[model samples]
Target chain A: MFELILTLVLLVIGFVFGQIAEKRHFRSIIQREAETRDLLCFNERRIPQDMFSPHVTLVCGSVVVSVDFFKHFVATLRNLVGGRVSAYESLLERARREAVLRMKAQALAQGATSVWNVRVETSSIHQGQRQGIGAVEVMAYGTALVPR
Target chain B: MGAYENRTVPEGINVSPVHPLKDFAVLLFGVSLSVIAFVIVLALLAGYLVRYVPFSYEQSLVSRAVAPWLEPSTDPLDQQRQRYLQSLADRLSSVMNLPDGMQVTVHYVQKDTVNAMATLGGHVVVFQGLLDVMPNENALAMVLAHEMAHVRYRHPIVATGRGFAVTLALSALAGIGDGVMERWVGQMGILPMLSFSRSQETEADALALESLQQSYGHVEGAAALFEYAAAETPVLSLPTLLATHPDHEDRIRRIQVFAQEHPPAMAPQLQPLPDYMKSKAKSNESQ
Candidate 1:
């Protein structure tokens, strides 16, 4: 009985805080993604030789996000019938976009006009395997080209 | 266009975030409810499927499956006492209402744990500690008959199958429910798991009492051992969920009441524990 109450309480807390946090995060991610959209980010590895710039360097950004108890609980339910865990899908999607935005910010900071060979790597960072993903770390990296 | 050519690309565009919390929450609730219904259907199907397995095959399957974990007992005392217990089992089996083709094989485990269990394949694992504690053959008879009742009804195999199905269901539940159900599933794969339903326990108890009534023509001291055990039952015990047996105290009272209603045809005379078994118990205890 106490456990049920505690679970409900945690769910409620997650619902309130998680909903607020995710909305805030998605907003930030959207705004940042749009801002970074024009930055020449690509997965292509051929670095355009010397045409771009001699100031070629690596720019990377990473973001780690955790799912609140409510979302995790939902994802676990989804696992039973074996469907897409859309909750975690959104989680990873948010993480990846945030990572990209940060990487673009780093490129802009370096005065680089464009970036190429963009790579986004994601991995599980915590032991929420049985449940849903506890937390995820996403890192976005690319080679920045400056017109130096 | 000239300004854009010279300026850093679109200074990080910002769009207002959409409101999705309400929709997400509602969708999650809907999905979870359906998932719950789906799980119930799966459990019912698994439960239904397990009942039709042929007795011989179930016995063979369960025996082979649990064989590796038995860790065969080598103690000399175990061998002697097992023979003692088996003969008693044979006597009771002769008179008890048993299922067709169900032959109880009593396996002696050398452990001192004061408990006995009926597992899959009509396997009754009796520990040495239980033998030492029995005041008389009557009490021991009660134990064997009780386990035999479990066998006649195929309780252990049904439980094992239930455990298997439930564990898979719980795995599917995964992150949805609280951690408690997961812990419950963790206990499933092992033998001698889960407390039998109260109905099953009562059924076994009644059957044992009937067997005692028939075998001795009088049931006496059969429940006395449980009275003693009830006194020793710990204040802190497994949660009802984890308890493999009914509370000895409550069960003792029930057994006494049950033994009285159907009076035995004659005064019961219980055989005392044999000296060889007593000596073996002492030696094993010393070790």
Candidate 2:
């Protein structure tokens, strides 16, 4: 009986807090993206020969986001049904966006005008067993082009 | 870079626009519903298949596992008590029309727990605590017959099989989640199992009441056993929904309803307990 009550309480807390946190993070990401709009990013490897003396440096940003209890529960359920696990969708979305934003910030800090050949990679870091704490690490790396 | 400009993509493109709660509600409802349905079907299949297992198999299995522990008492008085209870059970079974080759073996236990139970292999155990509280032989017959009814319906085996299947399946499903999810899944499985047990109890009560009416031509004292039980234990305090057995008050009400529906032809007579049984009960109380 105690376990049942505790599970219910944890579910409610996870859902309420997780929802609030996701909403707030999304708001922050949108606002930050608007502020950093002029920092250009591209997947193209070729650089123009006409471009004036530009300093090149490698820039990278990485972030790890852990799953909330409610999303974990929903995902466990989804495992049985074999469907699109929407519970982790927004989680990865946040991680991927955050990684890019951080990479852009790194380039801007170096007085770079644009990033070339940007790349993003994601991998899950399992803390313990299969059902234990789960988090995803996303790393965005690119070459920054700064005019001297 | 083409034009060297990064256009701001509109929101809600990558992430699904479906609200989290809506997705959660749908998945929770659909997944749990299917799991519960699957469990129920498995339980029913197990219970149905178990009934096909020969009663002799159940008897042999229990004899190997449990019968040795239920050794008959060596004390002369205790043996006499066991014999008397056994005879009473035999008499009730004769009128109750128990299926051929099925028999009830009554074991009189010398304890003071105020409890009686029926188990596999048609074994009904009557504790000394329960015997001491009997108001009359009629009430004793009601209690004995109730256990006999459980044996008649093969409830013990059916319940065992059902519970085993459900637990095994639920535990396997629970392996997909952590501690909290495991507990939650287990609790869901138990609800159906408990309800099945409660319905079995109700079925036994009805059959026992029928046997009581047949034996005494009236069920006037049938409710006495539950009344005595209710007085001794706070069993009625538990919520009826969760308990395996129905509340004592609910059982008494059922007995009263049965009696009212099938009026006896003659005046209701509650038989007094035989002198040896009464003496044995008194001796236990004194000790």
Question: How do all models score by TM-score?
Answer: 0.59, 0.93
TM-score for candidate 2, residues paired by index: 0.93
After TM-score superposition, the amount by which residue B217's alpha carbon in candidate 1 deviates from its true location, in angstroms, is 2.6
Where's the lowest-lDDT run of ten residues in candidate 2 chain A?
A46-55
Model 2 C-alpha lDDT per residue in residues B1-287, reported as the tens digit of each score: 23568899998877767777787788778866776777789989999999998888899999999988899999888899899999999999988998888999999888876778999999999998887778889999998999999999999999999988888888787667777667667766666777788899899999999988888899988888778768877544657777788888889999999999999998898899876675465576669
lDDT by residue (B47-120, candidate 1, tens digit) is 56887887899877876888777755676656777788888898899998577787998887776777788887
**Native-to-model Cα distance after best TM-score fit, residue B32 in candidate 2, in Å:** 2.6
Give the alpha carbon lDDT tens digit for every residue of A47-80 in model 2.
7675534579999999999999888988877777
Task: Tell me how candidate 2 scores on lDDT.
Answer: 0.86
Q: Candidate 1's C-alpha lDDT? A: 0.72
Any residue pairs clashing in model 1, and if so which? A31-B14, A35-B12, A35-B13
Q: Which of the CAPRI classes, incorrect, acceptable, medium or high, describes model 1?
A: incorrect
Q: Evaluate residue A104 in candidate 1 and report its C-alpha lDDT on the 0 to 100 scale.
A: 91
